[model samples]
Target: MFVSRKSIWGHTGKVMALALTLALNGACGDDDDDEGGGDNKPGDSVKVTGKVTYDFVPAVYSTATRAGTLAFSQVTKKPVRGAVIQVRQGNTILSNATTDDQGNYEITYKVPSSGSLTIVALAKTTTPSIQVEDNTDGDAVWGVGTSLPSNAKTRDMHAGHGWTGGAYNAEQRFAAPFAILDSMYTAARAFMNVRPVQFPELKVNWSPNNVPGAGEKDDGNIGTSHFSPSDNEIYILGKDGVDTDEFDSHVIVHEWGHYFESNLSRSDSPGGPHGAGDVLDPRLSFGEGYGNALAAIILPESMYVDTVWSQRTGALAAFGFDAETAPSPSDDPEPGVFSESSVMRILYDLYDSGSNESAYDNVSFGLGTFYDVLTGPQKATDALTTLGSFVNGLKAQSGVNTSAVHALLAHYRVGAVTSDFGDGDTSLRAIYTPVASVPYNTNVTLTGGVEANKRQQNQYFVFTGTGRTMNISVSNLSEDVDVEVYRRGTVVAAGYLSGTSPESVTFSSQANTQYVLVVTGYKEADGVYGASVSITSP
Candidate 1:
C-alpha cells in the first residue's frame, strides 16, 4: 500500500474490477409544492390544511396498487371524526372514505417516485404523518425481500449501535450521547499519526427513527454538537436501520465509521467518474470502506450469522467470515455471508496488512492518495489510537475539515482540514486567536494567518455564560480564513471573520465548561488551504 504514492488513475480503466465482491446493495427524495413554468411561486411550505387523500402502492412501479382513505375533521390536538376522503395521484383517484369519530385516518399514497415519498392527511383539520418514508430505507431492512408490514409502528429494524468512533472503547448508551466524548477524544489521539480526519465532539444516537433501503445516514443521531457553519446535529441510525432494538445489531458500528470520518467538509472522495473519464475522490470512499471493515473487526458475538447457524446445527459451522471460512445460510442475503467475496473478507484483508494496498479491498482501493497524507494525528484532528490518533493530530493542526480529501492530503500534518461533512454541522470549523487571555465581557476580535492564496475557509468558537453575547468582526482580516462561533452549534454569533482584530472572540458559557473553536475549508479553483483555530471563552 505504501510505495511512492502510486498514480491511482493508472487502474481507472478497470471500472468494474473490484478486488473483492462483498460490496452490497449498491446504492433520494423530494418535495413538490407545485410544478410550473413561470409559475405560481408555491409558498416555501404550503399549509395543505384541507382533507388530503392517498393510497399505498405495492411496488415502486406496480400499477395494481391497493386503495384506501381517511377523513380528518380537525387539525388541532383534540380530535373530531366523521368525514369522507379519497386518494389521488395526478388524474387518478383511488378511494373515498369516512373518519370514525376517533379522528384516526388512513389512505395509501401511490409510489410516486423511486425515492422517499411523504403521505400527508389533509382535511378541514388533521394530524398528518410528519413525513412518511417508503419501505426501501435500510439496506438490511429494505432487503427483507418480503411483503410490506401492515403497520409501521409495530415493525422493528436492526443497525450497528455499539460503535464508539475512531476509538474502539466503551459501551454505548444512546440516551446520553455526550457520554462517548472522552473515548472519542482518546481515539482521536491514536488516529492523528495515520489517516486524516477531524473529530468534532463525541455524540451518539441510539435509533435513527426512519430510514430504509439504504439512503439513511449513520452520520450521527441528534444529541450534541461542537461547531457549525451549516448543520450541527449528529445522526445515528438504530439496529436494523429502523431505530429500534430486537433485531440483529450489526449496523450500529458501521454507521459510526461514517460519523468518524464525516466530521469535516466532505464525507468522501469521488468514485471513478463515469464516461467523462473522471476519477472519483478517494477521501470519500475510504470512510465507507474503512467504517464497514472497522465494524466487522469490533462486532460482538451473538451478531454473526455463523453464531446462529452453528447453534442450530453443525450445518451452519461451514459458514464463517468469508466463503473460504463462513457457512452460508439459505436465509442469508445474496452473495453468501461466508464467501471470500463477503464484506467481512475484504475488511479483514485491508486491516491485516496495516494500510498495505495489495491487501486493500474494493472500498479502500478507491481511497488511494488520501491514504498517504496524515499517517498520524497532529494539531488539527482529535487524537486517537496508534494510526487513528496520528490522523487526529493532523486534522487539529491543519484545521480545515471542509477541504476535499485530496486537498487535505496535501498537508502532511503540517495542516488539518476542517469540514462538517454535512453532518449538518455547517459551523464545523472555525479560526481562533490562540490568545493567552481575554476580558470577561469585552468584545475582542482575534487574527491568525492562513496559508497565502489558499481557498477561503472559516472556523467557529463559542462564548456562553450568564448574559454574554459576543459580537465578531469578519470585515477585515490578515487573510480570508473563515471564522465564527456558535451557541449549541447554532450560528447565533460571530467572531474573527468580521475583520477587526482584537484581544479575542468574546462569549459566555452557559455550562462554563470549554467552548469549542473550529476551522474549515472551502473549494477554490486550485484547491483548499489550511486554516488555524483560536478562541476566547470564559
Candidate 2:
C-alpha cells in the first residue's frame, strides 16, 4: 500500500514530531550540540509543494471526411490527477504524495543539509491499481524526475509533447505515458460515479518503439492497440511513423472496456479481428459494441477518433466515427443484432438524452441503469453475453421503459428478445437443443459465413449429467471438428485435434448438474457434422 504522507501528518503529526525530537536529542547528546546548525537542524523538515501537468493534443475532426487530425498548435496543459509523487534523496525515499483533482500535491519530510533530492511523478495509483510502463525498457514504470529545491520552496513538473518542427523527438516523449493514464483515470472515475467499484490492477504498456506488427511484444512489435486477456494487459501503439494512440483517449478507454468486461462483467467472445460493416459473431459483436459505447459514455464527447500517420506524405491523419448516430445503409448494409455498429448505436441511444435520428430513442436510463444490468444480470446470464442477452437483461430491470427498448430493437432489425437464449428470433431459437435421453445423436449443418466465427460456424446443446462418466464426440468425414463441454461458465473438457475427422472427450460429471456442449467446424468450414452424447456406467 502506497501511503500518503499528508494523511499520516494529519493523523499523527504530534506523536511523530515528539518521537523525532527525542531521537535527535539522544543522537546529538544535547540540544546545545545543534545550536549552531543554522536553519538545518537535525529534526528540521522541509515542505515541498508542486503541481503536475501534461500537454494534451486534441483531435480536430472534419465533417466532410469524417476523420481527424492532430492539432498540435492547440495543445493544452491538463492536470495529471491521482498520480503518485515521490521525493527521494539518492536511493532513499523521503516522502510520498498524491496529486489531487487540481494536480497539486504537497510533501514534508526531514531533508539532509548536503544531499540533493529528486522528485518524481509516477504514472500509477494504488486505489484503482493502474500502472503505465515502457515495455521496451525492461517493463520499467514511466516517470519524469526533476531536482527538488533544498529549501521549503515551491516546484512544478510538466510533461511536454516532444513535438518539434515536423516530428516528435523520441528522447523527449515524456507525455505519452501520462496521457494514457489520464484517459484510464477518466474511465475509472465514470464507473465509480455510478457505483462504488474496486477495479483490479491494470497495467498499460506503451513505448515510442511499439509498432504495428505481429511479433514479440518486448521487442516493440505490438501488432495493434488491444487488450490481451491472457496477460490482462493493454498494449498501445506508439510507433511515430506508423500509428500512435497515446493521445487518443477513446482508443485507450475502448481497450479499458475490454478489461472491464473480463474482470467486472462477462464476455464469451472468441477474440478475433473485427471492424465496422462486418457481420460478426454475436459474442464479438456485443463485446466490441459495448466497448465502443462505454468509451463514449465515459468521455465527454460521443465521437471516437484514432490518429495515424500517412507513410506516403508524412502527414498525421485519423479515422473517426460518431457512436450516437447510425451508419448510412450504404456503409452498413446488414444492420442487425450480428452487427457491431447496430449494437453500439442501440446502447448509446439507451444512455444518451439527446434525440437520435436513427430510431425512436426516447429512453435515457443513464449509466446507473447500464451499470446495474452489466454487473448484476448480464454477468450471470446463462447464455453468452450478446445483444439478445443484454436486451433481455435491460427489459427485466425494475422500471425500464420496455416499449422504448422494443422500438430500439425493432429499429435495428431485432425483435423483442424473450430470453437470454434469444427465443424471439427464429434463426436462433434452435441454437441450443436439449438432450433428454442417453445415446443422443444429432446431425447439424455448419455454414461458412463471410468469415470464421460468424453466425453459423458452431452448434450448441445442453443436457443433465447423471453423476457418471460421459463421452461427448463430434465427427465429420470431410472436415475437421472440435467438441467442448462446459458447466457453469467453465470448460470441463475439450477435444480440438487438428486434421482429425472425429474429436472426443470423456469426463466425470456431478449429479443433477446442467452441462453445455458446443460442436464446431475447425476453422469454421462449411460441412455436415455429427455430434453424440452417451453415459458410461461404473
- Candidate that scores best on TM-score: 2
Candidate 1: C-alpha lDDT: 0.27
Tell me the number of clashing residue pairs for each predicted model.
166, 0
Candidate 2: residue pairs that collide: none
Model 1 agreement with the true structure over 1-538: per-residue lDDT tens digits? 1112122223221111110110121110011222222311222211112221111111011112211111112112222233233333322333334334343444443333322212212121111111111111221110010011112211111111232432211222111121122122223333443544445532232333322223323333322211111233223323221223112222344444444444532231222211111111122223333444454444422122211112343221112222112332421232211111222333343233234333212222212223333232311322111122223333343332324322322221212223322111111122232323433222233322322211123333333343444333333333343443443223334443322343134454454433434333323334433333433232
Q: What's the TM-score of each model vs. the native?
A: 0.25, 0.87
* Candidate 2 similarity to native, TM-score: 0.87
Best by lDDT: 2
| RMSD over all Cα atoms, model 2 | 8.4
State in Å the error of residue 62, model 2.
3.7
- Model 1 residue 163 lDDT? 29
RMSD of 1: 23.6
